[model samples]
Target: MGKSTRNVKNSFITLSPSFFTHLLSVSPFSTPNKNPSPNLSLLFFLSLSILCTFSGICLLTFYPISRNSIPCSALSPSSPLSPFLLASLSSVLKDYSPNTRNYDEPDLSSSAMVPLPARGVAANPNISAEGRDFWKQPDDEGYRPCLDFSLGYRKASSRISKEKRKFLVVVVSGGLNQQRNQIIDAVVIARILEAALVVPVLQVNRIWGDESEFSDIFDLEHFKKTLQADVRIVSSLPSTHLVSKQSIENQIPYHVSPMWIRARFLHQLNEEGVLILKGLDSRLSKNLPLDLQKLRCKVAFHALRFASPIQDIGNRIAQRMWIEGPYIAVHLRLEKDVWVRTGCLTGLGDDYDRIIANERDSNPDFLTDKLNIAKSARRLAGLCPLTALEVARVLKGLGAPSNSRIYIAGGEPFGGKQAMQALMDEFPNIETKETLAREGELTPYMKRCSVLAAIDYIVSLSSDVFVPSHGGNMGRAMQGHRAYVGHRKYVKPNKRMMLPLLEDESVSEEEFRSGIKKLHKYSKGQPVLRNNKLDRDVLAYPVPECMCKR
Candidate 1:
């Protein structure tokens, strides 16, 4: 240690030679014990107080300060700022570590627990179809365009009129031409929704539908006078066709609002107060309402009193009307390319010359090689199956036996003709289109065949499987049929994705067999089963073919 300094404990604190000299020079008890010079005594005492205060502060800063212990910085030896800073810092540290005061250990019992809601069945399909559509087609995607309704209402709300109300049904006729059967269904749904106040406005291509037939259903003359309580059908200039939006609006009548029409027409209506009845743009089967109660309610509330099902119109023809029997309603779509390239009945890559040559060269017994080619070749195979001739031949050969009648519904007239001839040739007892068309239209045929009921079995080629088409109404209709049938084995192919063209190339027979196995397993032993919870949730009560049941 230095002569004038020493280590006390672990700290080296020094009393320098100069510090002692200065202390001695200004000592109050030295000499006559007179008070030293005022300046010198003040400086000496201040310096001594500071040295002691600093040493205390160093100790306090490094260690925790208790409430009772006043930090040296807070209570400065000769000033007030030190005490203030110390007090502020002490409060800051205390507040920062408030948990330090927590004496008891944390209760671990409640830490791992998660609260769950006490609610009925976690999934319910009985909710509104509007909500379902919204969930399926999110807002981020323009599937359901975010309509700006701020000018009208801040928050969109569903409104149900207590008394009677007026509803506008906009029929959007775009994309592929809707099957006549499908159109009628859409119309019926619209009438069901509005009851007596539903007005139908058909917006189709300039040259799409038959105006006379449309007018007969809508009846514009009677509607003008208000004598007709049924839906008023009108054909306005399409908004999409016109370049100007305002121009399109100007063309529409005052009675019909294009906004309401478009909303209902595009299936984009969100059930904001007014209910919109979307017409047949796409297949209703494929995009069926997940919430069926909402669908039924919407239909019941909006449809007109005298609205007719499209099937009725088709069935009205003077055909042998079999209500429920054994039959097959075959639908063969006259695919555009199939007709243009193949010359209607002839197969693809064959023309009139090729047909005539084939007919002449083929065996006398099989003189109709051209006819056979026509029936066999297809534009969109799997989508619409082969002609009735081919289907009947295959079915008969497979041993469908006697009483089976194949009613060809849509497609080329020649295809239907060929099928009728084949059925007549194979099973003379079999009923022809003339015989069945004499009975009724598509629906009656469908009903008779037990296709839509609990049938013993549904055996067909690759095309006719569950949900008809991929993400199409065909699939949905199949589900509906299965549900209606109670519980049945839907004997369909397993992995064979039944596509339109390239049927042989796209899916293998093995895959089709696998799918059939899976479908059979699901169906169990019943002729039908109601498995689609989405459909059952909403369509539990008033089932289709209700009349046939009672």
Candidate 2:
């Protein structure tokens, strides 16, 4: 026997004698009997001995032990316990004992902890076949995009003299949407400083390795024309200021007031005549003056038009999607980088988890949540991205038919097609850019990530129903854009509310569907004003400030 098994047996053996003695001492039969007979005493002892033996046998049979510690082959065929009995006992022990593990059994601990459905399977097997009216457009709620900052807004050109005209050159970094945000903020910052804004430079994407310039993605002439009255946007800095340029190395703090901007940059800009700012992403304040915020809306919605080629292809894709009836655009942000950076579990099993964990370990700074929350707790708190299974369940619950055509935006998911298998299984009629476009359509922009993202953005903007699986730059941009155009059907998953219900195995299909419907009643592109008190992004929730009610 192994050391652990021997120790267990020895401990039980040592305790057995004392246990019997204590039992006998506490028994009423043990009380002194004056007329006790020898035969009766012998029979009583025999009965007690038989009972003790049976109890010991039962204890041994049910005793929890490491399955590897004791070999089943050790028991001889002639032993009192039959093979069937031994197998039954093993099975019982396996069910009850936490430590007893069968190597042959699949590891369910991860799934149990996560509470997500199996790969390529819906969360609820019995999905409702009844179709939902996803075609109905959401109520506009009397709101319309009104970028009317004209009343109190002064043009920067009229305010700043030509002699004191300082040039502001900004280098915007990050992904497509992030860069878009930075570009909007750059214009606002230039207006704040009363400086001529040079066309913001697009930082080379480190991951994508695409050296795409600003002109490559956005229409240069249209951008300049749209903001001609607000600020002077030039292709390059003036020759006089080129040699005297000052670069700001430190990052500007978030939510900085206009006064702070003037105080910090006005004198330096005047002296140098040219200021170069890098890493301008989220550097500008969220709660700028109404005019600046309006300016922001104008820049984001109107000024920043996609390049001709990208626009043409994007419009073509959007037209194609529209031709096939109303289609749902799903911004499935399941990229490996997203998983690593957000520290969100992919629910693709332990292998993917290990891959993410490995990447996270290597680049600790990439993790968005620095709180060091537990994975399960993070998932429960809705920090994790909705898995393919979860997305399928949410759609089904929201009344999307099995035959609903889905246009999946965003890049290739972590596990490629396999990651999207569940969603495809739930709704087979799905199309992505590659599948939708012709052979030579996307050839030129094949390696251009930003351009590709722009294509997706346009298609998403025109989609009948837009569903973002997680909150990110793209989702936020789309939310505001859809609202600005008209309240299109946008479904923001109630992850915090829906995750617990999804994890709950006890919730029936009907109950799950009802719960989902209830959770998302007010979430479907409802025209609610942005809560500025909460410091919500105006770009994401552009309602009262950027919109006017009819």
Candidate 3:
């Protein structure tokens, strides 16, 4: 974790008056008691004074540094830049020292220990120094350092031996309110990488940012430490503009937050790699050109994990909403967590409006302009009208009882308490809760359930089947083995063609067409999704007997 050194400060022999005389025995000039020529005497005294000062400075600077210890000044709160200086001085001393300890001693016990700098890729010897200096940045007045009071020194000095130079897995969340599946996807990927996890604790602009959506599955305090270790940084909202208002920025204790800041920071993030599975449905996937498909794959494998859903949550929640004997988890997603917009309006303006328009189209009633249309369509298309009717139709076709209790868990499409009420109205027999009180724990209802993780699972398991609503990231995550459906032609085009609309406020039909030509071309036939099912290799667990029963 630190450089090794042999020169202990207390063990060094001090140069006393007797020692200075002894040193003169080995030098060209002998020590004189007094000089006769005044000019010559003055020049000799000046040279001696300069030599003593230089020697003292060199000895003092290198002594403690040679011991491979962070300097005392670096540990003090007042010294902001001393940590970097101390590390630099230690490196210099290590280079010049005669007796250096070999950290590379070959031992079977040290196999788990992090390796020293080998041939090409150098171990970051300065990570500790950088971390220490990061801690030294001014803490806000009212803000006590959230880090351990002893500072990051202890954790910074200790190295957890791993087989490779590990990378971190950061999850950039849109917000806590929406994108629970994306959060789950982030968690699944973290497990895959065997890396620590963190979320950007954010202030709410749209939904309650503090809402603990995935608390049932993960730990928060442990999450915070992961961020401190630079293993992960999950943000609720990604700001394109890096400028932070002075007052807001000053609140940061270590002056660190959501912004990883630049491409280099992203490049340096090897210890934590993200599997950002976005919500691209098969319908959209079919319409995308091979290049766009390649782009999606590149982002999935290369940059981060990009994924989309084969079915919407509205549909999934409906099919799996079992409130009685069989309790099921029905998670409804109301917002897009990862902003997938191409250009300017990706997060703002009229371009933003179109994005919202496309999202709202999941509700047929939303297409019809009622506030409850999204909710109505959500219920009708999912379970109550469509699924219920489909259940009756299936029962007629198969001859089984059509009586079963279902549970639905979700927020309103229009957003908040009012929307929940509309959903409750759709199915009076089913149990529904606007907000479950289970904080950081799974509810009792979810535990009792031998559940359908999604509608695709339900449809594959039971006789009731309906086409899924919109492209969903959660659905893709749940497709363990069952076949999936996508609306390639029905769903709108990829987000790339939408970029020009952001660049121009008023886009004409011809201009839009011309711009669309810039998009990577796709197979022009029926635009149906191909290979919509999950690749068997990607499942986290074996496909259970219940899932494959059909």
Best by lDDT: 2
Cα lDDT of model 3 by residue, 1-550, tens digit: 1354344232334334444545454343655545434455556566577568657766764542312221222222333433223222232122222332223321111111010110111243533432222112121121110111122322322332121233332323432212333343333333333333445222222322333233322334333332232223343323322224311111212212123222223443352332222331121212222222222221121122111121232233333342122222233333232221211112224654466557645433323223443333433333211122222222122211223233342223323333244334433444333232225222432431111132223222221111122224333323211121111111112333333442465876455544543441331112222334433222211122111111
- Between prediction 1 and prediction 3, the one with superior TM-score is 1
User: Please, what's the RMSD in Å of model 2?
Assistant: 30.6
Would you estimate the TM-scores of all the predictions?
0.35, 0.74, 0.28
Better of 1 and 2 by lDDT: 2
lDDT of 1 by residue, 136-228 (tens): 210111010001112111111112211133333344442122322234344433433432223444444332232323343332333322211
**Whole-model lDDT, model 3:** 0.28
Model 2 alpha-carbon drift over 4 Å, by segment: 1-132, 155-157, 160-164, 532-534
Q: What order do you get sorting by lDDT, best first?
A: 2, 1, 3
Off-target runs (Cα >4 Å) in candidate 3 are 1-171, 175-217, 221-324, 327-400, 413-428, 434-471, 474-550
Mind giving the per-residue lDDT tens digits that candidate 2 earns over 406-475? 8999988999888999999999999999888998999999999999999999888877788999888999
Model 3: per-residue Cα lDDT at residue 510: 56
State the local distance difference test value for candidate 2: 0.74
lDDT of 1 at 329: 36
